[model samples]
Target: MRLLLLISRLDCLDELDALICNAFRRRGWEVIFGEINAIAADDYRCFTRGLLLPGSGEPCHPGPAALGNRETYFLDECQLVWVMSPPQDYAARDIWQMLWLASKRTAFVNSIEGMMFLDTKHALGYVLPKENRVFAYTSNDFSFLWERYRQASDQWWVAKPANAGCGQNVFLLPPNGPNVRTTLQCLTGNAVVQSLLYNGEVGAFKPEYTILQKFILEVANGEKRVVVVCGEAVAWYGREGNPDDHRSNIAQGGTPKSVELHSGEVKLAESIGLKLMEHGINFVGIDMAYPYIVELNIGYPNGLYNEMLTSGVDRSDRVAELIIASFENHCSLLR
Candidate 1:
């Protein structure tokens, strides 16, 4: 079967290709990398790339035409549209209409609506219940922060913008910093200062650039989990941080290692997968650090392809099988 993976082209995605594309090839199915651009669409009309994918309807093929603004467009050849990652423009624009359409048209690993939910670390406690989940301690305003810190001079707190992940614009306060309001404005439109989380070390708590969350000490498999409901564990890898640093996200210069999941971890991964399905998010890449779910890469998860090569396991083939199975299941119910 031919599948289309739409995403920005970047070197970080080497692992993804190794895991997915190589896997598909091994299964005797064709895998195609598709990047959709509106202007490029007009130039390549009615043209099919040399990728073979089969679905319930007919052999579906997709190309740049899948993206053009002919107002209404449909592809009979494309059985699935895998949005590995939306275009760079989409994030800056906040909302992407085509991505929404693709979700409706075909099986989206992680639907557009799903990205709207899990991309930000703010309001994480809301998505993650306080009962099973831990929240980064936070105060709504600067005055509350100053008063709280002064009461406990020995305590150190770190503040993060409402919505940021992957270590973006994180600030560490030195017990006291002037211009609380200005700091809030600069860091986040609305921000919070929260008590730092650590095992025993004391230097500065950046909270690893997401939420000021209550940290969990999970026994990780070295590689973080990226569970894809429509397929197998297509990829697994994470950055490794030394004592000086806590986060191991590859984007932060951590070394990559293959992750192996135990059966319980697999079940935990599946439960979260179903939760995402409840939110109309079927396919996702889960980041399980150690104890619980740390981050969810829903938009377009990269790195699996490369990891596949490293592990000699092709998750893409499994993903293709899962997609076919789901499609068949849907069609069967209709029949």
Candidate 2:
């Protein structure tokens, strides 16, 4: 059977792509790699029916030479699709919608609907403990958050865009900070403002609408990244921000290091894994600061590659096996 990996392009993630491709190839599966634009344009239908083997250094066949007059190779022949890129703009969103509709008939690593829902940084509050939630959407909501912070005797707060990742545009707001009003004015659409969490404080807040949460200071050392695949917490590591910054995201100059999760931390990650499976998010990377979740990464998480390089623990084999098993189960159900 054929498995499709839908990506934006193959230039940037060469190492990661090679690992995944090799894993599936060793399992005797034909792997197809295609760009989102090409797939959205239905270009695969014009190609001959054949497996796109890994390390071949060739594009997908463009003419029907091996199998004649087959028009449904992508939709009918493929059993599973792993969407490995984020939809960053309107065109990408359209392509994602098309893939979402197609997923009704095929298995997907993480459903488009689930990705859209969980991709927002604020969605973690729904599954995490109440003390770890925070949300906001408007100026009025900021006022409500401020009032709650005041009532709780909090010293500082943090603001972040609800739909962003990699610690972009996140701000720390002290109670006496002069730019609170300006920051609130600059924010539009969905945002989250929460009391700074430190020293065992509950650190929760509320918006006039939606939910709000506390920002964990456990990040002072760094945050742990737990990679979960098909309801199992397989591999994990640590990420520390630059000395001058408080954010522990690798994109923001955070450094990755080997880490071991405590017993309680492992239990928490497994529990979150179970919940993510229920949402059809089988492959993801969860960032946490023991006892609190910082973010849930659904689109193209990359710690595994670095982890393998540094630690020599290649979890990609297990990830590929789980993906194959999930696809087999899904196909069997259809039959």
Best by lDDT: 2
Residue 152's lDDT within candidate 2 is 45
* Candidates' C-alpha lDDT: 0.50, 0.66
lDDT of 2 by residue, 194-216 (tens): 43443334444433232234455
**Looking at model 1, how many pairs of residues clash?**
27
* RMSD (Å) of each candidate, 1 decimal: 9.4, 8.9
Query: Where's the lowest-lDDT run of ten residues in candidate 1?
Result: 60-69
| Candidate 1 C-alpha lDDT tens digits along 1-335 | 55555545422333453345444555555555543443122233222222332222222222222211222223224555555555565443422554564455565545666676666555345455444354455644445544554564443344565555554554544444565435544443233232323343444223332233333455223437465665345456554653454455556555666656777666666766666666656567777754466666676455555455458665656665676677668658867
**How do the predictions measure up, each by TM-score?**
0.65, 0.79
Query: Which residue pairs in model 2 clash with each other?
Result: 133-212, 133-213, 134-211, 134-212, 134-213, 135-211, 135-212
Off by over 4 Å in 2: 41-51, 54-73, 131-154, 189-213
Mind sharing the TM-score for model 2? Answer: 0.79
